[model samples]
Target chain A: MRKDDTPNQDRRHALECMLWGGSGLLWTVAGGVPRSSLLGTPEAHAQSAQGGFSFVHISDTHLGFNMAPNPDPTVTLQESLERAKSFRPAMMLHTGDVTHLSRPGEFDRAAQIINATGIETHYAPGEHDVVEDDGKDFFQRFPQGARTGGFYSFDQAGVHFICLNNVTNLQAGKMGMIGAQQLHFLEQDLSARSASTPIVVFAHIPLWVVHEPWGWGTEDSAQLLRLLARFGSVTVLNGHIHQTMQKVEGHVAFHTGMSTAFPQPAPGSRPSAGPIRDLPPGELRKLLGVNRVTRVQNQAALAVVSSPLEG
Target chain B: MQSRRFLLASAPALLAAIPMAQAQQPATVTIDDHDYAPRELRVAPGTKVVWNNKDDTPHNVVSTDNPRAFRSRILDTDEVFEFTFASPGTYSYYCSLHPHMQGRIVVG
Candidate 1:
């Protein structure tokens, strides 16, 4: 095949896989960007007096990571934290992989840095964090349950937030799995909620299939989505690929948050999935940005704005 | 002045206690070139085993059992993973991504 046609072919194949996978029809992309048909028409900003709840979504801090892929991740994290604080988010949702390794020192340093922000932080475990010791160190620091890993659910601002663990049983080249136990819990967790209630699902890996070949997506996510489909408005947030990508299926919006540490090569940029280094310092910030989610009420629409940290 | 004289007289005993503490330091086993530098490490019980990623690519050091099982996530160069061995036994580990990378830790 011609070199130019490679990306096109890959995109075509990805769409085909999504169709066969049976989640929903692939949303059309205008200019290599997936259109959010599922996202309801953008409504006017609700009256400021109505008071909307907004939260900061940051991922892949990779605190201990120090390399050419943007050396000194701490600076980027500090910048992101400062930006997050400026918005005065009600809370912060860290999608996971907080540290480069599950080292106590790394966790301690990360905890110290994040605690300095004074924002209530919710966490989930990334594949990187649980790979070592099956998440013992992670749970030790950010324990959520008797499971000894970071997986739990909470409610805030009239929305149910379910943090699922997909990185536990990872296999090479395979997407993340939430496992049968968690699946059962999810079924029971939402059993009492009314269908109209807004639901927010957070995970480390993309719950929707992005690219299974490079492990960019999750395996067996359809089962989880099937459970979520019952809700009228569901927003799924994830961070693993270190880049921002979004997909929307009926009543479900799947958004991947960018990493605060470094950016990864686009789906077909390199021969395989790895850190995409060599960007000018200014450009790196643009590639790695933050997404803010705000909700007003049942009738009002949720506004998601992506802002780059670069000045 | 008399208390100061007593402290000076006990300085040798205090110095003697310092070596005992130094002798209890954990023995570190470095993972380099797809192999543990020492191959087998022996240390006192409760000694912490640190696996430093000196390789360019990502590598994992995974244990073989349940409670004792541990795996270092993908580590870039200069990243370090430390686990303290609380029990006296032989702990075996291998790189889940790169099976060729393997080593053993013997804690007494």
Candidate 2:
């Protein structure tokens, strides 16, 4: 769909062209094919919750970041969590990049806000979060996957949830890597699960290659996907790109969420991948938000609704 | 009287220190928009190189060559990290956070 959009050298106009393009897409995967609708229509807003469960996914809070596009990321993150709470999700998944610079105080600030939501939140580390002590700080603060180097899994509502860490030990000039250790863990973990069970895998970087130049994809994600091939329904959620992108292949669906901190240029829309500063006043929040995923009981379908902090 | 004579004698040494300090001033590489300015820098052995992050995002410098010569802590905007290239060799480095932002230092 974006192929029709022309690339503009003007950064602001380019951002406008790309940022507004994907904002209101309501994504759903039924029968292993993805579909979308404009948000706010009855078909999009309406949801059936009878005998079903839902969860929230938010990413890239970047708590300590203080700059244009957003001077106080903490405020936006708090707002996102409050919005997430309203969904009454059984749990929340943070795809990674909880802090901007991986400082202790930044983690403290992020914790205070996320915990305030009172929802169990699972985390995967982004490259930014593991900059300190090789992710010892991140693991110590969020110990759900600490023993296994920040990747773990659990069963919730008959859906198997696997949180994988792909940011550590990243090779130069390459995308995020899950490495051999985590792949072995994933293989072992999935082997015992029934193939009929729905699987939701969440991580910091997109399991599929979004763009090679910016390192938006995961290096060993193909191997990871192969392990998941036997599953009847698989939905992959990620957060590193800081924008909304979704695709479906076979029985697998991939979606990347927006950041609560700031917006980044769409793939190949800018010279380099970083925060998109100089956005018009009040436009930042529209491009920054969270994802709310709903799973129907005994159904292979998952409805993913994205809500902006504003608009 | 002895203190005054000592001060006068030390004045020449202090005067000589200024130029020596100036000679030791490090070469700079500005990190802006996720790219290092002067992506390839040439410096004499024993010269110091400093990386100044001017972009809003945080970045770090890590040697990518075999044996990994130098690494720096994450540098936020306006923060600086320095490494003295005391050996003559081709040093390749990149921002660990954004690996695409690569650079090289040729010391001879």
Q: Which candidate gets the maximum lDDT versus the true structure? A: 2
Weakest 10 consecutive residues of candidate 1 chain B by summed lDDT? B1-10
Task: Assess each prediction's global lDDT (C-alpha) against the native.
Answer: 0.68, 0.80
- Candidate 1 wrong stretches, greater than 4 Å: A1-51, A145-148, B1-57, B61-75, B78-108
> How does model 1 score by TM-score?
0.68
Candidate 2, CAPRI quality class derived from DockQ:
medium
Q: State the TM-score of candidate 1 restricted to chain B.
A: 0.72
DockQ per model, Cα: 0.08, 0.53
Models, CA RMSD each: 11.6, 8.8
**Can you write out model 1's per-residue Cα lDDT over B38-65, one digit (the tens) per residue?**
8778765655677887754466777766
DockQ of 2: 0.53
Instruction: Rate residue A214 of model 2 by lDDT.
Output: 86
